[model samples]
Structures are given as structure tokens and as C-alpha cells.
Target: MTRLLGFPIADHRRVFIIALPMIISNIAAPLLGLVDTAIIGHLPDAIYLSAVAVGATVIGFIYFLAVFMRMSMTALVAQNFGADDMAAQRHNSINGLFLAALLGVLLILLTPAVLELSWWLMVPAPALQNLASDYISIRLWGAPAALMNLVILGVLLGRQQSRQAMWLVIATNAVNVIVDVWLIVILDWRVQGAAVASAAAEWSSCLLGLFWLRKSLALGWHHLRLNLKQLLVLLRLNGDIFVRSLTLQLCMASMTAYATRYGAIYVAVNAVLMQFLLLISLGLDGIAYAVEALVGQAKGQGRSDRVRHWCRLTLLWSCLFAVAYSLIFIAFGEHIIRLLTDIDSVIDTAGHYLPWLMVLPLIGHWSYYFDGVFIGLAQSRGMRNTMLFAALLGFLPLWWWGQRFENHGLWLALTGFLMMRGVAQAIWLKRHPQTLL
Candidate 1:
């Protein structure tokens, strides 16, 4: 068939064009982490990057945990579209919004505890530690708004309204970039500038997202109601997503904490390395997300043949990208790290590990790719269970065992985590071939 899942190439092209912007916009958010590193790295004080490191790590925990809102919302909305139910789509968005807000408020309140733990973990120079606290506390205020923006974007993507998701991201990041300069250059707010810029942009983005989401859901305003049945459905779907996110964060946090023991420069440079990982993953993520949306829609319509076609096409694309990614990472790893951080020590630390980084694009690509397929299948419980199991059995054990060693241990543990994900998700997918069918 010339067509893809009955939608035709033209239909996919339209979706792809729209999704490109969302990918670009989404890409900018991760840059802020890089920006934090760059700004602090270039500052008169070398310690600034370390400050950003500790603060960014803490805030990252919040963002990573709440990622479920995006994952679940996208899958749910796509399913509703396939079912031809506009009402269900609207309710899912609303439910995501309410939940996002609740989670954000809770994060704001619990930030003090998070801050305390951060201080305990980092015995960096006292000045650096204080800077970290200030940056983290300021950044925490944006939690609610940032989480809401994530939910809104997910909802838009789910609806195949990729253009809108793109525009929202562009506007938000534009704001973030502007404030980042003004506060850092003019107000001379070092770490404060980076933290506040992120928070302000997040809140601004949430406002913009609300405008878009409200316009889309306005028609069903009077009809939208969450009774027991609907509430249970919403919880079940969102809960699976939540569990998956929690497992991911736990696994990642282990990596972060372990990096700290290697020293701040190591952790800071690795932080930059991780940003590269996110950028590469998100670029390819566009394809995986597209596959998920299409596959879910096909499954909704009970078209197993269409599902098969989409999955095969997606795997083909992933294989091609895998080869390309390995080449790029191997060839340009140093140049990319240099562009992000200027510190000699940080650069050297990263260079030593660049070889392993090359391995990630090829060997580690499956985890990110499978995550998309599982989400599309709405096998959140399976994914969540498998991920958490890996974190405990595969990830945590190695990470804990590695702590007694040098950089080798930390590197081993981190690589082991990604490898476990690839192997475990593959095993899980093979056993549940019904998902592909």
C-alpha cells in the first residue's frame, strides 16, 4: 500500500511538518540546562557551573517525575481521535491540567525538603552550596507552570495539532532566551538569573498554553464532567504513566548522585553530556512519537495490518538512524561538548567518557524508541513494571556496587543502566507481541 495506516503519505507529511516545530521547540527547553552551564562556566567565578549543577539536578528531578503528564496525555488524546470522540479528548486534556496543577503545587511546598537533601549531598565550597540553594528555590516556583505547559503540549501533540505545539514552544523558548540575557547581563544575577529566567518562561508558556487549550476545549465546556467512571478511567491511564516516569527518574537520579561522588567538575561535565543525550534522543524522538500516534490511532480502528505496517516502517527508520547516530557521535563528540562548556577540566572529564557516549546512540537507542511504542500501546503498566524492575535489579545494584570504585565504577554503572533498558524492553516487547498485532 502506498498509504500509511490508511492515512496516506500526504496525511503523514502534514503531521510530520507540524511535528517538526514541536521537536525544535521541545529541543530548546533542554538548552536551558546547557545555557546554565555555559553562563556559569563563562562567569568570572569558576564555581558558578558547580552551583548550576547542583541546582539544575534538583529541578531536573521535578521535571523528570512530572514527564508522565506529557507521555500519558499524548497517548490518551491520540486514542480519543481514533475513536472519533472529541469529548473524550477534551476531558483528557482537562484531567491532565487539573493533575498537573496539583502536582506543581505539591512540588512548591516540598521544595524545602528537596533543597535540604541537595545541601546534604553536595559538600562543595560553602559559597557554591548557597548559590545552588538560591537557584534551586527560585526555580522551584515555576514547577506548577512548567508541568502545566508539558501537559498542554502533550495534549496538542495527541490531537495531531503539532503546529500549535510548535508555536507554543517557540514563544516560550523565545521568552526564556530573552530573560536569560537581560537578567544575567543587566541585573548581574549569576545563578539567580538562570533560575529566574527558567521559572518566568515556564509560567509564561503555561499562560500561552492555557489560551490554546481553552480555545480547543471551549466547545465542550458545558458538557465536560468527571463522574466516578470517568475519573477512574482517567486515573488508570495517568497512573500507569506516572509509574513509568517515577521509574525513569529513579534510574536517572542514581546516575546523577553517583556522578557527584566523582567530584563537581565530573558531574557538571557529565551534565553537559547528558544534555547531548537528550538533544539526540529528542531529534529522533519526533519519529518515535509519530509512530506512537499513528500506531495508536490504527489500533483504535482495529486495523492490525495498519499497525504492522507502521511498526515495520518505524523500526526501519530507527535502524537507519542508529547507524547515522553512531557516526555523528564518534566524529563530533568533542566539538559538541566544547560548544557547551569551556572549562578545561570539565572538557577533559567528558572527553575521557566520549568513547562510551559513542556507544549510546547505537546501543542505547532502543530504550527511547521502545518507550514510544509502549506508550502508544498503552502498556504503561508493563513498561512501568519492567523499568522499575530494571532500576532495582539491573541499575541500582550496579550503581551501588560501583560506588566503591573510581570514575570507572560510575561510568560502568551508567552504561549498565542504559544497556539494561535496551535489553529489558526488548525482552518485554517480544513477549507481548500482541501489542504489535
Candidate 2:
């Protein structure tokens, strides 16, 4: 018991077993963006890169709004697993996939309207509107496959099948990169090619994921049938997470919208910088995924003590990793920027704001870790509330005030928002420990 409390070697092993594969997978996932950006960024014109950035942001906004499916699936499946309820786990996965399919179809249907509305909101320059529109038009074709992949991934993580989950992500991105190079570089299909590659990869991976889970699919179909009661429960959980994810994506989209006001150059620069930030968030998320699985399992077993232990050790390691990210960025961030784009102006502008990038990991790491903790505890409402407070109260006001500083102001507001979320959630968890049990 003493050894367990003192960061036992066994605990570290458990954490890494789950975290390492996730970390590798998460890292690979964002490289999709990096690869796209790098390929497009090298174009003779920066407009293509900016258009992809804006288009991707719009697609991400829609996709993330639907990502509540992923989050809820992970938590509930993890809890069910911990309680040794395999039937419930299978049921959840089946329900989640059905919902993912419906939602994806809805997104495809709404793409035209969404694209028009997005342009109105973003108000990009005339030249950019058509290019971005073309990119988005092609990308939405894969909406069904993309959302389905999210469910498969969430279920995989919930089942603690990290290695399998890693492969799914790797395969998806690998196909994306190969297609990206083939069409964009070899055939000069440009931004449209990037979109096609992404869409194709999604379809390919969805088929692969279904094939991989054929055995589970067979068992799940036999053991249970879907029903309204179970789905309602999932929907209620997904509802809160939906709002939370939507708000989060909106806040992120605002950064891109704001950048558009400054011109395609600024948009291009922000895209590159945002990619760096994405890498950091996803990398740290590897640790948070472990927290979600372990803490959630502990909660299912009614073992609050185990919940506390996993949270503590995971938090320690996540923060350490966050600090390491900051240091690496400090040392070599400019070089990374150079690798992403040959545009001299983009590189210089990105370097100016590089300090903000260095500090963001430290400020944002807590929120990422706490999100996992709350999700594991099935405290969806708390997650929603904290994010609202952070975005509405902390981020917007700081952003408003920081406008005096231009792009630096945008970074400042985002930093405050992240800090507010972490602090608020931490206090809540401290005050209401019952949630964990």
C-alpha cells in the first residue's frame, strides 16, 4: 500500500502502457495538419495555404461539435469496463456508431448552408472565399467516415486497447500523407488534392476499423439489441459534451476569424502557429486519455482511493511533459516554423509570437489534465460549466483588452481562458470530492 501511494514502479508502468501508444498516435494525428500545411505552405502563393487553414478550421468546427460522441463513449465504456460489464460496453459501442452515422449524414446535408454561414462569419477576402469554399466542399464528403472513426477510436480507448487505437490513427494519417504527396506534389492538384486525400483516408480507415473489430461486432450483435432508454442516457451525456466541444471549437475558430481580418499572410502565420499549439494539446492529451480510462474504471469499481492515486500520478507526469514541450519550443521553435513554410514573412511573424507559444503549454496543461479527470468521474456538467466560464468570462474579456497588442492580444486571451478553466475545475474537484466516488 505504501509503495502504491509513493509512485510505485508498477503505477508508472501502467500509466506508460496506456500513455505511450496514445502519445505516439496523438503525435501522428496532428502530423496530418503539419503535412498538409507543409505541402501547401511551399506553394508559390500563400493563398492556397491560408485557404486550407480556413477550410480545415471550418470542418474542424463541425466535426468537433459532433465529438461529444467520442468523449462520452470513452467515459461510459471505461466505467462499464471497470465494473466488468462487457455487455454494456458492447451496447454502448453499437449505439455510438449508429449515432455517428446519422450525425455524419446530417453534416453532409448541411455543408452548403454551413459553408455560406462560415464565410459570413469569417468574412475572408474575395480571393480566398472561392478557394476555401472549394476545399470545404470536397472535405465534407468524408463526414460520415470521419465521425464514425471517432466512435471507433473512443470505444477502443475506453476498452484500453491503446495499441489498436494507435494503429487506427496511424493508418488513417499514413494514407492521408501518401495521397497528399501524390496529388498535391506529383499531380499539382493543390488545395483540392489535400481535401481529397483527407476524405479518402477517412473512408479507408473506417473500413479498416470495421474489419479490425469484426469479432467484437459479432459478439455485440448477439448479446444485445439497441433501445431508447440506453440511447437517451448516452444522449444526455453527449448533450453536455456537445455544448462543451462546440464552445471550445468556436473559441479556436475565433482565432482564425480574427486572423483573417489581418489578411491571408496573418491567417497563414496563425495557421502555422496554431498547428504548433495543436501538437502540444494532442501530445498532452495522451496522458489525459490514461486518466480518463483509469480514473473512470476506478470510479466504476467504487474505488475512490484508486481514482485519487491515478489522477495524482498522471497529473505529475503530464505537467512534467508540458514543461518539456515548452523548453523544446524555446530551443527550436523557429526552426520548426522554417520547416513548415518557406514564406519569409510567415516565419518572421511566427517567431515574434513564439514566446506566447512557449508559455501556452504551461498554462494550458492543467485544463487538459482536469478535463480527463472530470470526464472519468462522469462529471460532464462540470466540464461544460468550467469551459463556459473560461471562454465567456476569461477568454473574451482578456481578448478584448489585449486587442491593443494585435495578435499578441489573441494569444493573451487564449492563455487566460486556459488558466481559468484549469483553476476553476481544480477548485470544484477539491470542494466536491464525492464526484469521484
Candidate 3:
């Protein structure tokens, strides 16, 4: 237990307060995808599900790359709050939204190139590619709105306004799910309908977030002016995060591509399995988000002891949750698989892959927790280097050799990648003890 003012304090309450809303938000984030999957999976053909998988994977890659905006904004805002620098916090919020708008437009403009490049790399079948193209085209239009929401959400989390952030996420995802069902099931618009629903929900969230920020921070347009030096720092921080995100996205895209090579059934199976993994990762990330704000604040206040205390408590909670998740997966993996897709073939194939899913929580929790710690500290370089090492030295080569094992090999390589990420980051922390302290 940590002590303050000569009294013992329970860290779990503090941590849980920050984490609970985020846990709901994080879980809701993936439930959006799961909803899309469940909606599309019931269609007569597996192609609809496969197309959604590939299209969503590509868009997810692009959007995730822009996640630097969210991560950087949270850390900067949290640090500013810790230092009692209201002006700087407001400035960061304004500039973050501005940057997000810029990046969003760029993503929209590059849609054609992105689609061309994605098709080239993925080499999906003609029918599947056509459906995927339709999906991506519509979804790309939402990039700006989606990215803007990321920045706003970051600001909320950084300020420890978790309840507000939680409601925003819940509302946004609820809109997506309702619209998705109406458009796809009621109107029979299929893949394009899913895209439209997502875009509408994204824009709604962005607008709602801006409205919330206006009331919460009372921000003024005059404060949105660009600062070249601050912009440089933002870019530098986001640049490192970009590299880190790129490597992570590459690992993900590679998994999808490799799975595609195995056949559409495998691709669909992998897609469903990946959702389970996403659910676990996002749930764990709730804790990481809490750590990001808490650690960043601690760092800003020069409270090294508080930082250490947070790290210990967060790691303990993460391990316990990982155990709980593993047990749940082990017991209900088949039932969950069946729930995601009604197709006997897809369900049966995914069942064969359940063991990997069952074990993933245990192996992957460390890397996820450390990610929050590093992001909170705003130490992007270590994250970048470790991911590079993990992807290039650990995952890719292992994936190559594991090809003999087919889909099993792919899962094995991914497992190795997760383990290596945690191990390498641990070594990095050992070498630089000041980060945690």
C-alpha cells in the first residue's frame, strides 16, 4: 500500500474509478466491430462477412495509424493539468483538433491511392475486392470526423473526465449499432450500409465531442492559433508514435494477409477470432488509459514515487484480469464463436482456433500495460524501437518458419510477437530505470 499524509491509501479505488468508464468505452469500441460482424455474418454468403473483414481491417489500419493524435493529446493534456498550466492544456486541445482535421482531410484525399495500394498488397479475390472497395470508399469519407473524435476523447481522458468520455463512447457506438441494424437488416443495403452507419456515427460523435468540450473547457477560437514551435514538438512526438503505430499496423495487416492466403473460410475464421482478441486488448487498454493519465500527471508533478506506485498497482490488476479473461475464453470459446457467425463452416473453423484465443490474454497483457506506461510518460522512442525489434526480429521470421504449420503457425508467430514485445520492453525499462521511477 502507498501512504499519503501518514495514512495508508487504497490505490485500487483510485485506479478503478479512472479505469471503469474507460473499460466500458474500450469494450464498446470493439463491440462496434462485433456488431458489424454479427450483422454481416448472418447473410446467406460468407463473402459479405469476408469483405467486411478486409475492408474494416484496411480502414482500421489507417485509423489506428492516426491514433498518435489521441495518445499524444492525452499525455500532453495530462502533463499540463499536472503542472496546473490551464493555458497549455487548452492550447494542446485546440491544436490537437486542428491537426486531427488536417490529417482527416488528407486521409480522405488519399482514399484512391490507399485503396489501390491495399488491393495490391492484399490481393483479395475479384468479387471480394469489389465488395471491399465499396465498403472502403464510403468509410473513407468519415476519416476526418473519426480522427477529430479521437482528439476530443483524448482530451476528456487526459483531464480525468472519464464519465463524460464513457457516455460519449457509449452514445457513439449505440448510434452505430442501431443504424447498422436498420440499414443492413431493414433496408438491405449490405456492406455499403455498414459504411454509412459508421460514418454517420463518427461525425455525430465528433460534433458531440466538440459541443462537450465547449461547455467543459469554454475554449475560444482565438486560442486555436498555430504555434510553430509547439507544432514541431507535437509532430515530433506524433512522428515517433506514427512509426510505432505503423509497425503495429503492419503486424496486423500482415496477419490478415497471411490468413487470406489460406482461403476465404480461413480469412473469415481469422476475422472472427481477431474480434475476440480485440475485445481482450481493448478491455486491458482501459487500465492502460488510466495509467496514461495518472502516470503523466505524476511525471508532470515530479512525483517519482507516485509513478512507481501506479505502475505496481496497475500491473497487479492487469495480471489478475488476464487470468480471468483466459478462464472465460477457455470455458466459453465455442459458444462465443457460434454467436459471432451462424455459418456452420465459419463456426467450426474458428472452433479449431479457440486454444490460441484462450491463451492470448495471459501472453499479451504485459505489452498492453507497458504501452500505457510509455504513452503516459510520452516516451515514444522506446515504444517505436521495441515494436520494430519485435515485428522484424521476432514476428516476421517466426511467421516465415511457421508457414509449415499453416494457420497454426500464424497464430504461433503472433503469440511470439506479443511475448517478445513485452520481454523487449521489460529489458528496455531495466536499462532505463528512470522511466518508472
Candidate 4:
């Protein structure tokens, strides 16, 4: 009789169980970024750390561009699964892999041009700029493998295998840590080592993901066909995801650019805080992904009752997790930030922002939950439109105010950004309850 969110989680423990591995895996993904920052931040000069920040943040957006494919694949496959069409689900997985490969090539070609433009980005020191160049040039090689990993994880989620997804994350990170040690400490490769390590980890995961995806799809392998009808469905679904992703990535790129206005230290400090924010936000988002798969499939099966139940459990656990974790962070937030970097200035700056950072998760739970629900119901247009408005109306104006007010403006804008995005998306959800499944 105990409540999970608004539902009896006792009967739906499987959904939470399915999301657990993803939660841990999402946590690990951030650890990789943190490790890179820690290693580079501890180097003799601040330039080294700032260089990694510039380079990594730039490429992180690149990595996010592939997110649409991942989200789209998850929605499509989950719907197929709920329809009890194993063949269609398998086909969607394959479609995702092919699409990832195609996009990988496009990203690879865009690299040299991106680097040339990256040079124009407002990095204060030349040393940092060079480091950014080296890191970007080397890491761009992994675009294909990285994108493939996204698809693989999406398919596994569609099939309700979050444990496997988590295991893959663990295995991939192990490779990264080991390789990072060899390159950074052993060979003294510095910032470039971290970049290489990230790419290597993705390639390793892509290999394993291929193996797992193949086995999963082999069940319906015989029914695989690349017909026009399925292609249209995949393209349309993925197209919306792409637009949605572009808007999201633009918001990130804009954030970094806007921060760059305050000079490299602000950008650098923000870069670290953004990593922490991503780690915490996405870690909470693992629950949303759980809701996405469950609700999407439930919709397909016309199991409206189960969809509502899943949403209740997900929202409950996510808010509780956010509150509990944020409290622990409030208690030891600065202590934890200190461990990641020895730079006293950056540490102080990050801590100043840490309290406001805490509110982000709570205010954002609604949007994250709605995103999952909309994806599950394949309501990408609603998701896309709402985010577009948030970024353009909610964030940009707030950022403009931040610029006008000096330093305080950015912090207020960021907080406003989180609050507005969540509220705007909730409004959209109200108009489109079906997206809630």
C-alpha cells in the first residue's frame, strides 16, 4: 500500500529495477568527465584545465547531437514492443545503427571546419587554445563509435534491459580509466590523453553494443526489411528528435558562449559546474528514461492504466532522489568540489554557484518527467516546440539580463532557465495529456 509516486510501486518494482542500472550507468558517465577535469585541472597551469574545458565542452555538444537518434530509437522500439511486434522492434534497432553510421561520417567531415571555428571562440590564453585544438582533433575520430553506442543503449532500453546498459557503461568506463592512466600519468600526454581515453571508451562500448544489439535483433532477424513505410516512420520520428536535439545543443553552446563573455575563468568554472549539473541532472534523468520506455510501450499496448502508474512511480523516486542527493550535496558540496580540483579560485567560484545549482533538479523534475512521457507517446513535436520556446524566451532573455547586471545576472538567468523550461514544458503537457500516455 506504500506509494512510489502516486502509484503502488510494490506491484511495479520491475520498472524501477529496470531503471536502476541506467541510474548507476548515468552516474559513471559523469565520473569520466570529472576524472578528465580532475587530471587536467591538477596540472601545473590553469591554462591546462581551461584548455580541457574549452575542448571538452565543444565536443560534448557534438556528442549530444547524436542524442536524437538515441531518443528516437527508444521511442520507436518501445512502441513496437508494446504493440507486441518483435519484428518491428528489431528493425528499428537496425535502422538506428545504420542512421548512426551515416551521421558519424557527417560529423567526421565537419571536424576540421569546427576546429577552425573553435579557434575563434573566446579562450583567454593561447596555451589553452592549443590544448583545445589538440583535444578536438584527436577525439573527433571517435564520432562513429560514440554515435553507435547511443543507438545500442537505446535499443537495450527499448527491450527493457537497463541492467545490460549499465554493465556496458561500467565496462566502457573501465577502459577509459585504464587508458587515461596510461596516457596521462604514464606517457605524460596531458589533456590530449583524456580526449583519447574518451574516444577509446566509446569505441569499446560500440563493439560490445554491436554484439548485444546483434543478438537482440537476431530474434527477428528474418523479418528485417528496409521498406519505405518503416523508413518514413523512422525518419519522421528521428527528424523531430534531431530538431529537438539541435535546440538543446544550441542552448548549451549558447550557455558556454555567454559565459565566455565574463572571461576564461568564468567559462572554466562554469564548465566544471556544468559537468556536475549534467551528472546530477542526467542521473535523475535515468528515471525519466525508465518512464519513457514503460510509458511508450504501455501506450502501444493501450495500457493507459500502466502508463499512469509508471509515471507516478518515476516522478516520486526522482523527486525523492533529487531532494536526498541535493541535501547531501548542500552539506558537503564544497568539500566534494574541492576534491575534483585544486584550483582555489575555481573551487570558490563553483561553491558560490552550488546552492543555486541545487534548486535546478527540483524545479526541473517536471520537464524531465514530461520529456520521458512525451517520448514514450511519440509526441516529439510538443517536446520540440516547448523547448524551442524555453531556450529562446526563457533562457536567452534571462542571460541578456545577466549580462546587463554584471556577474549576478548569469546565476539568476540560469536558475530562471531551469524554472522556466520546466514550467513551459508542463504547460505544453497540459494541452497534450496524451503525451503523458
lDDT of 1 by residue, 1-437 (tens): 36765546775575466446657766775675455456558778877778877788778776877777888887777777777777787777777777788888888898888877767766667888889889988998998898898889888877777778877877776777789788887788888998898899889989988888878866445754544565566678678777877877766665566677778887787678887677667666876777667777776666778777666666666666777877888888899889888998889888988887777777667776777777777778777777776777777788678777766566677678777877888898888888765
Model 1 segments beyond 4 Å from truth? 1-15, 30-53, 123-131, 181-195, 220-224, 259-276, 337-352, 396-413
Predict model 4's lDDT versus the native.
0.77
| lDDT for predicted candidate 1 compared with the true structure | 0.76
lDDT of each: 0.76, 0.87, 0.86, 0.77
Q: Clashing residue pairs in candidate 3, if any?
A: none
Report model 2's TM-score to 2 decimal places: 0.87
Query: Candidate 4's residue-wise lDDT over 1-437, tens digit each?
Result: 88544566574577677777887878786677567567767778787677777787788777777688878888888888888887788777777777788888777888888887777655446766778888888788888888888888888887788888888888887888888888888888888888899789889889998888778767455654565677678888877877878877776666567777777877877777776676566567777888889888888898878787777777777788678667767787787778667898899888778877677667766677778888888888877887788878887888876787654577677667667777887787777776554
Q: Candidate 3 on 129-176: residue-level lDDT in tens?
A: 999999999998999889988899888988888888898888888898
Comparison by TM-score, 1 against 3, better one: 3
lDDT top scorer: 2
For model 2, which pairs clash? none
Q: What is the TM-score of each candidate against the true structure?
A: 0.84, 0.87, 0.87, 0.85
**Candidate 2 lDDT tens digits, 316-366:** 988898999999899999998998899998998888989988998998999
Candidates 1 and 2: which is better by lDDT?
2
Q: How many clashes (backbone N, Cα, C below 3 Å) per candidate?
A: 0, 0, 0, 1
